[model samples]
Target: MADSLATWMPPLASLDDALLRYLDQTGVAVLVKDLTSGRFTAASPCAPRVLVASQDIVGQTDAELFDAVQAVALRAADQQAVALGTAYAGEHRIERHGERREYVVWRHPVPASGEQGPRILSCWQDVTEQRKRDVLVQATLAQLEEQQKANAELRREMQDNQVRDSVSGLYHRAHFEEQLRREADLSSREQREFAIVSVSIDGMDQIRETYGADSCERVVEALGRLLKANTRAMDSPCRLGGDRFTVLLSGVGLATAHSRMEHLRKACSQHIVAFNGQQIPFTVSMGVASFPHTAGSVEELMRSADRAMAASRAKGGNHLTLASIQFVPAT
Candidate 1:
């Protein structure tokens, strides 16, 4: 189709003008580049929409019209399309008037005719708004998935009466302990490792004293939503009373657990709870420990994670700490 568009030519100059006029009426941005001279030979009326704002581009090279970097990139793409002898499609980003714009372009090589050397027939369309809409759709889908998970968790709680806290909607400590035991047993049988994280809300007491009691609940709810959104179905998020929480990551190593918890810690630090037109800021400190790697028993695992969490809190919070692995000397 691109080859046909490039090679289609009428025998009369009037028909050529008519063809360009028709393309202009259709609002298609089109330009013809003389490959030998590396200069644009012709452009449609709508070509300015994709390229520079100048109406005249007939005798201008890419370097004269676009910025240095973009000019080189455009020239390289043109050369590649010509060498391949086929149509090329690509997306390009261009900054104009302090705003970034994205464009999708197709370039096809036209055969030499008469005195005219081989030329590149180029077509482009602005896709900035389309790309924005795609991003918006993806974000919306993610939010919907999070909401569905929350609803499912709620349904499970209603069926089994397992929820511990009303505000955060997280599992009870007993339920979390049961899950942890089951995970340990499964990992032991499968010869794999799982991770556990101890979480503590930093400055919760100060926040409660400053912003009143309800402010602390607001932060807890926000943290619960984040935990649910970030965790998988197999993982468990539990509130261990007060401002403390724990997460059980099934079949995860210490490094992976630390990375994931670090992201969560950052999210918590950035999150602000709004109440009665006032903003309450909060942060969390996390400790990541793995099963059989950091501790051999549940009692030792909780203590190791707790010690790491204390260390993170000592560093002024909003940090994630990993428990050190114990090495035994060979006899």
Candidate 2:
């Protein structure tokens, strides 16, 4: 609640023309209260916007101008500012036309003059819209973070599903070759040994002719499962199309690779696939070779392993073979 500008202006200070225009035009509500009489002594032209319109606010107490609850709060803040002899700030919520609004109020105690006694200067600023915008920004940032995480998970799943052979669930030949090159480089650089094994289903042609293509697929799938089960997580097992498969064993030597492959060969020979109301038994032949033992390079190692596998199939099905060590003269 406020009075005419001329009546309240004289006590506070000498107001210049520019200061008078600013007080009239600004949205901030400025008011002064007399501490002794507990009544409003001065007000800006815009002060009426802070409360219900009244004809005159001069010499009016908060109880006469505002509701009971607001009156008590206003009185408390004024007393606190005067007692502290400094500026104090607080927030208040008011409802008008069924719409709730928020404001930040600041109060400062003005020293008593010759006859005016002490006064409290107060300014009120509306902050409802700024608070709403802050909430909206926080919610938007949270939603965006969730969406980014979801997209990253989706991309990982897609990569896992797309880079493997559908039937064997093992990496494709292209991926296998990439791994081969990487392993070769690592072994050469670190002076460490690793093994490569080439595998093929023995008597595959005869089995396909005797039991149809579905039977062949059943046998291949069974061999794939056995290979996966027998290999370590660090090993790379790949399906190189048709009945061919290969494994790369990291940090393994020739003897260890041969022992592991022999175990896998036995597992393949023992596994039976059930199909079309009949059980089909199958066998796989594998050849084990090591880097710097059987061959010096990736290409040479693969060729040597393939030759050994062919030799095993020549002997009989369900057998494992090891590539011969290359003899080199002392340099």
Candidate 3:
């Protein structure tokens, strides 16, 4: 009975017609190949546009119609699907009619007929436009990323300029004060030690009278460079006013702070300002005050350092004085 039914079974004319209609409406290309012979069995009308011509492709192996590279890829995909008994899908680039085109190809196992051996059904759709769009989008995203990076760098430079001293390129007095306040708050909360060193240039009036404001400015600039060179990376130096500067030393004890101030003093004493072919010498007097040792707040620390600086100027003009450390007893 099984043999009789197989012999009298009608051909799948309706199913074939339906499949052809579906392919035409969807613009999909279909092809079937004999797995044993590696020859094309059927090609849909849309197959020619995707590089599979019905008249020339029938009964032709991929090795015959494609170049070595294309043949290798097609055969590999075909073998993969056959061995796994599963569908394989991939994007491939094929050259047809002197133009390169991209297609999304799929290979699936097909049941064999009585006369035909094992077979595989293959289908593909043109994806050239979609691939081009994807490439364009990726390039556009890369360009946007580069532009964003450049913009961020420019903004950082602008912000740095805004907070920096124009003449010395160090933090301006305003920015330095803000930073001192922040550090003071942190030190108070964390119970850490920090110091503020105030420096005053002695006899600036005489220098201005003898040389001029420009000469005085040059001297201040020289002193600023000397201070920066002598200071540590964590220290911040700023010009507080005419002939007055300040430094905030974080995590420094009185001994270390005094040493730092002494270094600055030596550097300032050595710095000579040249104006009108004349070498003019200057000196700086600094005062150091630490957090919780001298004062608990930013304003008090600055005041104590300022008073010590004035005392240093009275004593000589180029000496450093450590402010009296007043520590509050722990509760």
CA lDDT of every candidate: 0.85, 0.83, 0.81
lDDT of 1 by residue, 1-331 (tens): 1223334332123335566657667665788888999988776667876665664787889888778998889999998998999999988898766788888889998778797889998887788888999999999999999999999998986865645568788888889999999998998899899999999999998999999998888989999999988899999999998899999998899988988888888888888889989998888999988998999988899999999999999999988899989776799
Q: What's the TM-score of each model vs. the native? A: 0.53, 0.60, 0.73
User: lDDT tens digits, residues 174-271, model 3?
Assistant: 88988888888888788789989989998999899988878888888888788788777878888877888899988887788998789778878887
Candidate 2, TM-score vs. the true structure? 0.60
- Residue 271 error, candidate 2, Å: 11
How much does candidate 1 score in TM-score? 0.53
Off by over 4 Å in 1: 1-157
Per-prediction tally of clashes: 0, 0, 0
Off by over 4 Å in 3: 1-22, 52-55, 97-99, 200-236, 241-243, 259-285, 309-320, 326-331
TM for candidate 3 is 0.73
- The best candidate in terms of TM-score: 3
